[model samples]
Target chain A: MLSALPEAISILLSLEGILVLMLGTSLGIVLGAMPGIGSTVAVAIVLPFTLTMSQAPAVMLLLAVYAGSVYGGSIAAILINTPGTPQSAATCLDGYPMAKRGQAGLALGWATVASVCGGLVSAVVLIFAAPQLAAFALEFGPIETFALILLGMTCIVSVSTGSLIKGLMAGMLGIFLSTVGGDPILGEMRFTFGNWQLFAGFNLLAVVIGVFALSEVFIRASAPISNVSELVTFSGIELPRWSMWRGRLRNLGKSVLIGNVIGVLPGTGAATAAFISYAEGRRSSPNRAGFGDGEPDGIVSSEAANNAVTGGALVPTMALGIPGDAITAVMLATLTLHGITPGPNLVQENPTLIAAIFAGFFIINLLLLPLGMALARVAAPVLRIREGFMMSAIVILCALGIYFVRGNPFDLLVMGCAGFIGFLLRRQGFPMAPLVIGMVLGPTLELTLRQGLILTDGNFLAFFTDSPIAFVLAIAALLALMIPIVRNFRTSKKD
Target chain B: MPPTITKLKQESVIVQLLLLITAIALYLSTFKQGFTDAEAAQSPMFFPRIILMLWIVLNIIGLIQSVRHSNVTNPIASWWRILLVIAVTCVYVNLIGSEGFFLPSMVFALICLPLFGIRNGVLIVLFAVAVPGVLVLLFNHMLGMPLPTSRFTHYF
Candidate 1:
């Protein structure tokens, strides 16, 4: 691994790699600074454009966007008192206060520095931890893989944030939709309904573009337009004195660690991490009373934690075939589209590809400081682009991109239908992440379960008894499913 | 609390019933296909059937839970605005095949802008034309992805 580091750095330092990373970071910051766009939409919209490029630059571009957007969200939080992305909602609590106190540049600077530090730490964690976890996961057989995916599916319940039943239903619907084409093991066609186009199944790209991008247009079109605050001014890249940093070093470290840990937990996103870390900071910081009143610690905790989540979330995604959040889910879809299967064998089979991605991750963070400063200067104006115009462009792009894939008109219809369905489900409080997860993991779950059944000679009970790993994973999955219910029950009882 | 509960009850009942109907329809759709290789450990219909069963069970639980709490919030924009966007999208999708990429999409942008609260005709017209045109130029010419040609052009 140490020997490979130099090779990875050289790859990232290449002209093309640097250019792609720069473009991705800038684009991510712009989109992330814009309210209602978010990192997931940024990545999904970029996926179509990456089709013309090779896999390494394409993945690198998306990772840069993922990392850049998390940092970008804080800019809006500070300037407009609105988080460009949900992950920075906690930042807004203190960021807006700092900006109001005439320290807008300082708040942004703290956010930028903290984001860099957190992202760097998490990248180091990813570099060290992903391979080790992947090595362990390589021991998993079909049953254990099935169990692992089942555990992944349980993440939908955690992500629901509203109604578990709705999330579960949406997830089930996604799995069912994945069965629209031919059965993998059996040559028999199940749900094609006599259309040759159905034989290939709904294009994952079209579905992703439709569900994430187009559906967002539908939702945003109806959302009330936000007034961008124009009064705020950023003087220059200003950081706190060394004494300030020295005082809050412990807060920054703890928040980054918390962020990384929460990020590694599937379905819990950066927003959750930011809020948790802020609470922890309040609990332990010397400046606890100043948290929501222009305290530097509040901004550090939120920015550090949320940025750290980017690297932490990628851990499971690169190791297991499971995504830690929606952004990674889109990434997982991108990998599948590129014919690069991500699993335990990803590191062994595609060492260079994995190394390039890691290097890109590091470079994107390092570049965030300079790029983020420039972004902070222009974010407010860029974000003020009319919502209607943005929505219109997104819709047009969705139509054109879906058409470009295989030049199929049916794909446009598929995208349209999926967009409508996604809009409806989202409005009803069923999260979209679970749906994407179920679609991505559906075939794997079925294939593994059937293979395990065949291996067990048709004994379902043997699945539990024969493999200790499988049994343990199954129990973990069940616990994940039940934990929410148990927690809800306890809360209700207390009430 | 009472009003919120009542509203929740009404919305939940409607949503739950709609979900239940969909699940039933899904189950019925699979029933026509019948069992495929019933003796086989993993049949083609196996996964779908399991999913449908789970859907049915979850929908029932969801219906019961709805009676306990009102989760429905008012829609962000009016129903008409959402419907307008969907209606425009449906038309745009259908139109793109025959009308080609540029015109249908430009018109979609124009029509959608007002529904999305942008009433400036000049800005709408400029954006409507420019956004789609640039996309076509970038996607078709630059990226070399061939967009559909105008049917009228062929006739000419």
Candidate 2:
């Protein structure tokens, strides 16, 4: 790694490579700021261009986009209620409220700083700790994976401020909807209702776009259109004061660590990291009550963890030949398309290439600070735009983005239907975060639980005794479940 | 007569009841999903069944909570606006499938802008035309993804 560092720096310093990184980062921020147009779509759009370019510059471009887009997602989540990427969903819990309170600049600043910190740390981890982290993540099997997802589910309580029961209900509903397509294990068609489109089940992207973006449109439609001044007032990005950052270093560090560790695990994405980190921040912060109500710690925890996922995900992809998440899967495809084989021997075979990629990723994160601030300054004026024109533009973007997901018109209808369902659910005090979490993690939980049972020959006790990892995870899940109960009991006693 | 419940509470009650009914319907929908073997711990229906049961319980709890509490105040938007959004979206979707995106989306924005309270005709027309056209250029030409197009617009 030390020997390859010079070559890496040389390549990144090249004009073409630097230009690629700049272009990818800027375009990524643009796409990621648009509701429903996420990192996956952004990468896919640029994928064909990579086919014609050289390997070093090509990979750098995609990596820059990957890192930049994850950070860019928090912008929309802060400015509007809609999260640009699903991973930034937790950011919206605090971000939009801050924007509404005329602190959009401050919230954007917190997100920017948190994103840089997380991305930089993850890049360092990728260079030094890749193999060790990959080995650890590889030990997570069916039982351990299930327990981890259950641990994530405990976050529902944190997200649901007013009522826990309603949150769980919505989560359960989301999990059920996930089972609408063909059965994962049996390959049996279960809930298609004879529609061929239903055979594939509801697309997660479509559902997310509908519930968050389109439903927002319906909710906004009912209110009188106000000027952008009434929406979000901002001048320039406001970095937090030194006194404000006094004790929050621990929170930021912990969230970045959580994101990196979870990112190493295959299939768990940035959204999960954002949520788990937010919950942890809530648990550890002195201003815990201010959470879900525009707390700065909330923005830090979510943004830091979400951006950290970009590098953490690469750890498994490069070290183990496993795609850590969907975005990484697309990155893996790009690698294979460029005739580069990724696996354990990849480092030894292409040492300089790997080093260049890492160096480029670090540079991209550094660039994000200046680029993001500039973007925010430019975007602030968008608040001055007419409500009707702005809403209309957003509607077109949402419709077009969702259409591009699968190219099926049915997805459009699904978006409309989901918007209605989401609107009604919101009216009844049901939180959307839990529902999204359930949809995201439910299948993995069920698939692993059943697979573990099969492996154990239906003996549930084996889950606890089979491996220390599984045993520890199960205990953690149990504690997570019990914490709420214990808190409720304590509250009752105080009452 | 006893004091009438506020419209917001009434709406909440109706929504909760509708949820209960939907949960029941979801439960009934599972009848056609034949069960798997006994060795699988539970059949494919097991997950959905458990979920629907939870949905039912929660809806009932929500109903009780609604009656006992009168704190459902300050809904974000009014009822007609919500209906108008749903209707416009429905038409826009069907229009895209049958008539293509470019024209239908223009109509969607034109109609939706007014509903959203935009009264400037020039601004509305410019916006109605510009958004779809720019999106078409970007997604179709630059990204190489095909947008829905009918016979008339296919040449472009």
Candidate 3:
């Protein structure tokens, strides 16, 4: 591992790789700052361009996009009060208020600083800790994998902001939608309704864009047209005074740690990390009363956690080739397209590439401060547009973007249907994130489980007995399910 | 709160009905198809069946929860606007293959701008036409992804 660093650094130092990183990060920031267009769409849209590039630069470009996009989301969340990506929803609580109070620059400043800090910290952990973590993860087998997926599903409770039931409904609907494609284990088909395009599952990007972007347009269309306020000009962007930083230092550190832990968990992703971190920050802060009312700590905790997830998520992806979330899933697909498989053997086979990727991660984090600051200043004006017109344009862009992916009418149809369903679900208070997660993970989970069963020869006890790692994972799943139930009960009793 | 509760109860009942219908449909579909790999411990139907069972349970729980907690803050959007959006989308989807990308998207945008209370006809027309045309040029021409051109191409 120590010897591999030099080779990796050499590969990343290439001019082409640096150019790709800069270009990808810039494009990602722009795309991600647009509500409904997240890293998945950015990655998918850029995939065609990468086809002609060398493998190392191609992967680096996508990685830069993934990292930059996650941080870029806070820009819109802070300025417009609309999260550009779902992961930035936590940032909106205090971010938008800060902007509204004529402190948009300060909010942007803190977000940028926190994002860089989080990204750098996570990258450090990824560099030194991933191989060790991967070694432990190798012990996981089919049962453990199944348990992990189940634990991920349990996160639906936390993500369902308003109604858990509605969230579960949305998730169930997503699972059902996922089942529409060719059978995961067998060559059989289900729910294709005679359409050949249904042989492949619904494109996750189309579904995400439809749900977040197009559905948002429909929802906004009914509201009174409200123009975004004029961009607020600050005399100077101010950081938290040292005294204030000292006050919230412990909370910030805790949130960063929580974010990293959540990021390492498969399927939970940055949004969940940010949500949990913000919630925890609120729970533990001395001035909890200041939450959702322009508190800088809110920005710090949420931004730190969300950005830290960029590094934490890369751990499992690099080690096992399993994506920790939608963006990473796209990155994995992009890597596969480039004929570079990421797995346990990645470091051994291509040390230079891995090192280059890590070095790129470090550079992107360093670049985040200046790039994010400049972009935030520019975005302030654009964020103040009329909500209705902006939403309409967003819907148009989403439709066109989906159409551009494969030039398939079927994909557009899927987007349309998904938008309608998403609108309905949102109106009924259903959380859309769970649905997206389920849709993205469903196929992989189903296929893997079926294959595992095939290997077990129909032995009913094999899942529990085949491996101790699987048993431990089963226990973990049980605990995850029980924790929420217990917490809900305790809260009810306290109320 | 009481009125909100009653409305939520009604919604839950509707959701329950939908869940029941979906369960029956899925169960029937499962019967229509036999398991291809019987030797496998978990077949293709396994996860779907689990999901169906979970949905049924969740819907039941949802109904109970709705009854127990009645205070609800309904969204501001009217049903008419929602239906209008859905109907427009359906029409747009149908029209795209026939009319091509430019016309249908422009028409869709024009139709939608009014739904958002944009009364200025010129601005609506400008937005309706310009956005889609730019997208077509950027994605179809620049990016090399061919979009539907016109009725002549459809006939071919």
Q: Against the hidden reference, what TM-scores do the models get? A: 0.96, 0.70, 0.81
Tens digits of per-residue lDDT, candidate 2, A1-495, equal 669989888888889888998988887777677655578756655665565578889899989888888888888789877787989999999998988889989999999999999999899888876646444555567777666666656655555545677777777877887888888888777778778889878866567656666666676676665554334666778888878898788999999999999887655689989999999999997767899999999999999999998898898678755555657756765786577755555677787888898888889999999888887766444434665665666567767766764577888888778877887777667776677667766776688778888888888799889878778867866776677768977996899
Indicate the DockQ of the complex predicted as candidate 3. Answer: 0.48
Candidate 1 segments exceeding 4 Å error: A1-7, B1-9, B34-40, B154-156
Model 3 residue runs over 4 Å out of place are A1-20, A27-107, A139-144, A157-160, A163-166, A222-224, A235-255, A265-302, A314-357, B1-5, B34-47, B71-73, B120-122, B152-156
Model 2 chain A worst lDDT run, 10 consecutive residues: A378-387
Alpha carbon lDDT of residue A412, candidate 1? 85
Predictions in order: lDDT:
0.85, 0.77, 0.73
Write the number of the candidate with greater lDDT, choosing between 1 and 3: 1
Candidate 1 vs candidate 2: the lDDT winner is 1
What TM-score does chain B get in every candidate?
0.84, 0.84, 0.80
Best by TM-score: 1
Candidate 1 lDDT tens digits, B1-156: 777558656766787788889888878887677445655667887778899899999999988877776776554556688888999998898788788898898889888988877889999999988887887787677867768867886410
DockQ of each: 0.65, 0.54, 0.48
Candidate 1, A367-437: lDDT as tens digits:
99999988777776776777777788778877877776567788888889889878766766777888888
Task: Specify the CAPRI tier of model 3.
Answer: acceptable
